[model samples]
Target chain A: MKSQDQVLLSVRNLVKNFELRANSGLRKTKRIVQAVSDVSFDVHVGQTLGLVGESGSGKTTVGRSVLQLIQPTSGEVIFEGQDLTKMSFEQLREVRRQMQIVFQDPFASLDPKMTVGSSIAEPLVVQGVQGNHHDKVAELLDLVGLASDHAKRFPHEFSGGQRQRVGIARALALDPKLIVLDEPVSALDVSIQAGVVNLFSDLQKRLGMSYIFIAHDLSVVRHIADQVAVMYLGKIVEIGDKDAVYRRPSHPYTKALLSAVPLPDPKVERSRSRIMLEGDVPSPVNPPTGCRFRTRCWKATDLCAAEEPQLEIRSSGQQSACHHPE
Target chain B: MSESVLQIRDLRVTFNTQLGELRAVRGVDVDVAPGEILGVVGESGSGKSVSFLAAMGLLPKSATISGSVKLDGVELIGASRKAVRSVRGKSLAMVFQDPLSALNPVHRVGDQIVEMIQSHQDMNTHDAEKKAVELLEIVGIPQPDERARQYPHEFSGGMRQRVVIAMAIANNPKVLIADEPTTALDVTVQAQILEVIQRIQQTFGTAVVLITHDLGVIARVADSVNVMYAGRNVESGSVQSIFDHPSHPYTRGLLSSLPHEGIERLQPIAGFPPNMLAPPPGCGFAPRCQLAIEACSAELPSLVPFGDLLSSCIRADDLRSGIRS
Candidate 1:
């Protein structure tokens, strides 16, 4: 069991809603997407917590909300005994030094006009780290497996994997305690993805930092995550230790997701029975009545639509939000 | 094996750019039988895309092509522009990576599909529109008639892909080339698209050449697999043989790098892919291969058969004998 002191960050009842104009008319009605809904989790120091879900599942919103990149509608994000939601704008800027985010698309995230070296050094300059920035830039480039001379090149010169390495080096420039890696390897090829995932694992071991690794690929997450959280329609349906969550998934959504991952072995793939969901995911704006997965869930019943199931501890530390958990 | 539907022999393609003459594809050979699903698996810049682009006669004038590409006994290489266009939309069709970009945003999806049908067959507008709705229904699009009127942006990524599949199969092409069809989609949605493509192939009895970097996807759908590296086919075999016993070092490394179901840790490949413009003197993968020998750097290995599998490696015999040295 991990000690409470080991917890580097804790989130409670986090909620974020975006208001948009319903239609183009004199009466501009407001509509909320409810991107995140009552999400809570903890990240222990030097450990990785993987938040996984499909598009519009609010995984990215939760990551941004934790860093206060965007304002949360409600709930507390306690980082080292400080509630980030309560902090002022100036105070939040100070807190931002300890938390950083590596975006999904390195090409879009990195400034095209700027050199790769300057991009990495920008974080150091912002944090007022007293040092020869050039030397520090070279050191960081070397850290992420890029040649020191690569610092002179632009983002376009590097391949997808190299650009992502540059992005990682920039995220590490501030020496943040927690880094939210949002689909860091999803854009890269399979061979390149393995390289990036290894680099992330190696960085965590060396820097003793925590990561909220957000990705849709469960196999990649299993390689690095200490705990895994499965999100569906803005809610975490299941979360537990990586082994427990993967070996014995309680929620039907989790089971469906696991079964959908095609094995590399042809024999195994042919032998496995795929749990093919019947319908498409419902619109997030107006989700299902109760369980969001009930629309396509094979095990769903009348009770599943009557009331939403809250995430509750099923065992010692494992949690699942399901009416009929396997 | 009776008569290959699409046969490519020693196909080479080079693009004249400001930098230099970039040889995108080099001496690549591929064959697809009727009703076969041939999987072309490779990393980015491995020429998997370029090879098919050349076969389809879709490359621009800037690209210089060589060798032979025959589709159903008709030569695609050195064919006149009109000759290539004659066989393109009707006899062969390609499903590109991004359905949104491939589709015209200004027109409704149903209209675009109807245009394809009318261009290929002698059908009136009314009959074409009805056929378009039926094609959407065949692809499992919910509320096909309603979706037919919607524009490309109105449909979800998965639904847009379904529309793309519908367009590819509208003319009932003999061969369909899907280039990374599921790269932009989520896994579940990707599975749905794959199922739709498989259904279309089954219903139409068309051969499929699926190009993707994801080995898992290839394993799920491919009857035969061809592993490409640095613009060359390094390994080719039945799906079961490639997965169970990969003779080529690059193929083995790729399989090991993938995070499997029960494996606790993933073993990533060490180095990046070689530059295509200035490929290595010998095996393109020699620098990163763990089993590379001095001979591997002296000359390029030829693709040779190894117990029902073909691998381009000097040490295929040693690999079969479980000998590294």
Candidate 2:
């Protein structure tokens, strides 16, 4: 078990709300989309906490809130014992060098006009680091398993995987203590995705940095994540060790999510019974009252609709927020 | 294989681009028996989608296509436009990945299905409307009659895909070519979509050719798999043979690279897929193959049978005998 002192980032009661204009009859009514609500987790040093969820689950919003990229409406993001939400612009800028993000689309993230070398060195220049930018760029390129010569090439010249490596190299240019990788390998092919995932682990081991690896792919998360957190409707439905979560999912939603992921082995895929959750995810603008997942949950009762379940230690050895824990 | 509902032999497709001839699909062969799901798995530019598109005559005029594509013993390639059109939606229906784009934005979902039925068959509007609702119900849409009147935007991503599946099966086509039908949806929705496809295949006895890159999806639904790399078939066999005993290095590399339960470090295949404009001589995957020898680059390896698999690797026998797994 990890000690409390080893926690690199601790988030509590994270909430993000977005305003939307809706037309009801002739009048345009303002609607608030509660994208993220009361989300909390810890990312320990030299470890990874995989934040997983389907679309509209607000997994991306939670990652952004942790870094103050998209400022949360209300939350306590304590990084190194400092609440990021309370930091001023100047103070946040100083802290920004130690935290970085790698986006999902490598192609869109990198500037097409700029050379890969300059793109990597932008962080160093922005931070006002006293060093040779060219050498630093080359070093970063080498660090990301790319040839140093690749520094001169534009983003268009690189393949999808190489562009992603360049993205990682840019993220590494600042030598950040924590990196929030938002679906970094989702765009690459399976063969290319493995290399990048391995590269991430390799970099983590060598640099001793922590990661908030946010992705929808459970199988990919299972391989890299030390701790796993399953998010649904902007809430952590389940949180525990990767082995415990994967082996015996406690929450009904988590069980259904895991069951939905098809195994590569045909025999296993054929034999394993799937917990097919009926109906689509409810609109986040007006999420189902009480338990957000109660609409599709087969075990839901009057109690589930009357009161929201809180994350509690379950019999399956994970913290799952469910009225009826399986 | 001769009793296959859809048989593709020596299928080849080339596009005349600005750079040069982009040979999207090299010589390839596939067979889909009635009620069987044939998964054509490959990465981007691997021609998994293109091979079937050529068969369906869906490709643009710039591409030069050849070889035989027999759907129910009728030749598709070089067939007359009217002949191909007549059989396209009637006997060979196709479902695409993006459903929103496939469906008209202004038209009601039911009207769209009705249009498809009217275009293919001589059904009356009233009967077609009733059939549309029935198809929606069959695809597991809630309140099919009411839902059919709704627009495409009204449905969720999963529901849109189900609507697309309903439209594809409206004519009750003998063969359905679904190109990444579930790729655009979420995992849970993908599960539902796969279930719908499976149910359609079972209920209608439709021979389905599913094109996708996700190995997991392929494993779950496919009876047989055809692995494509750099526009050619690298491996083809039953799902068990392909997953359990991958003979080709590309297939083996692909299987090993996937992040699964027991794998600590992924063994990613080195180098990217070959440039299709001017592919490497000999085996297309030779440059990336870890076990590639001098002879592997000498000539293109043909799909030769190795036990239950038809693998394109020259060292398939060695791979089968565990010389280097």
Candidate 3:
């Protein structure tokens, strides 16, 4: 709902291609996997923009690219009016202090040998912050609803939820303006996931930071996001206000994706109709021609195959990339 | 319950670990009637999977399993190795969460199914191969003959799951225990896999014991649900009653915490699951439960009959009467 001037981060025409070696007989050919393509979005200050898609949708790639954790193949990742793609390693390193990311598995993200306190303080030491590191670590631990004493324990000492809290506290160590949360709560139990999600909301409100919350669970995304972008095979198919997208999903894939999520209510789950997509997601190496979702999309036609659909504003006020959006 | 295909009574499973005797499953009872889908729903370490694994005799030597696990009126615990093996694939089959791990990567998909079929039944390889193809077809694998020759890695995650299901049902087992079968899959693919399982259940009248952490999955497919807490069945009932009137606080907390249509914010359960090695003397959920009283921590509340269900909460009446917000 914020104006364009309030944008914390703006991504334009972003693309990431990974080169993979394919062996045939004796010779090896370089096959390009189009992980992310022409993805554009904006994250407003203090708001959460959810990126949702199944595996291989390149949602994770988009998140990593925004932080310049993995440099984008091509496009503009403008943060506070500065293009990150054009920045050198040293320049990007300076900018990295403002942006951070939280991975799905907290256990894997944290070093097993290191105490959680050290893990939280590592970012501060790396960025060369002028402060009592111990106090800052304690403050951060408290901020994430964990006791300061927990910092003394190793990563394995904490529960899954506690470890995730540690992951969040570490991300917050640098006082980042934007955090790219790549499936932060996916690995936790459903009950524990809620607590983490609530903590994210509370932290955003308190710290006034923006978040690009990447997740495959649509319901979780709906619960947390202000803006929602639905991706398919590297390209964003639909993107808009979370309410607009959830209430009236314009893209066929979005509609199907929404329908497929089984509601917890037994009566509703039983009575509701589901859109069962026929086959697996097409490989990123040789993505379907024109529309990436055309193979699974029911409304696909000759036009969909022959010409790629540009993302246009639909009747629901959401932008959808499809020849015939539902 | 007399005609139940699978009956589990007072089932307890403990693992000998460095810390202590880690009690994974403790005094749980479950029954799955013929053609019924019994959903064993819980979080990680709730012992939903461990209990069923103990029943399947799949646990390692470190596990000490006791109590009764009756499949088709036959006791599996303390049974002879040959007897357990004879009934495992033929009468009681299990489909694991990861299809890639369940299947042998080196063997052809069809050959694996053939091997499974030929293991218990005295059938020729040629006939078993034909039967394997038929099973693949039944699981909705298109171009079955051509696909059968492909390796496990060649198949997609969804397709690999279908092949796993095909192999599990190859012998037309009376009971099928699918443990988190769709957890690793995408939502769309998960729907397809659930449909396949439903089809197989309907076509063969096979009793299903579906273990999952997702309540939504249970609601979508389960006839009856057994809600597991720290290694115990906290609540068990028809899906309608379990969803509509959750008697246990843990079950209620699990439901309310889910991201649904109208909820403003999630009401998360306050604390972590108890440490199994040194779990509290009373109710396992007492520490986190909002409605817990002095009595709740003092004594373990037994599963007593409520309206259309059994609840372990002593304050089940208070819960049903809307005492708490």
Which is the leading candidate under DockQ? 2
- Candidate 1 wrongly placed segments (more than 4 Å): A1-5, A22-27, A112-115, A132-135, A147-157, A315-317, B261-265, B323-325
Q: Judging by DockQ, tell me the better candidate of 1 and 2.
A: 2
Clashes of each: 0, 1, 0
| Candidate with more favorable, higher TM-score: 1 or 3 | 3
Per-candidate Cα lDDT values, in order, are 0.89, 0.92, 0.93
Tens digits of lDDT, candidate 1, A1-326: 65423988999999999887776577778777888999999999889999999888999999999999899999999999999999998898888989999998988999999999999999888878897999988989999999989989999998888999999999998889999999999888887788888889888888889999999988898888999999998999999998888888889998898888877888877788888876567778888988989998999999999999988777636799989998
Best by lDDT: 3
Full ranking by lDDT: 3, 2, 1
Over B101-216, each residue of candidate 2 has an lDDT whose tens digit, in order, gives 98998999999999999999899999999999999999999999999999999999899989988988888899999999988888988999999999999988988999999999
Mind giving the per-residue lDDT tens digits that candidate 2 earns over A176-198?
A: 98999999999999999999999
Error of 2 at B229 (Å): 0.8
lDDT of 3 at B204: 96
| Candidate 3, B214-254: lDDT as tens digits | 99999999999999999999999999999999999999999
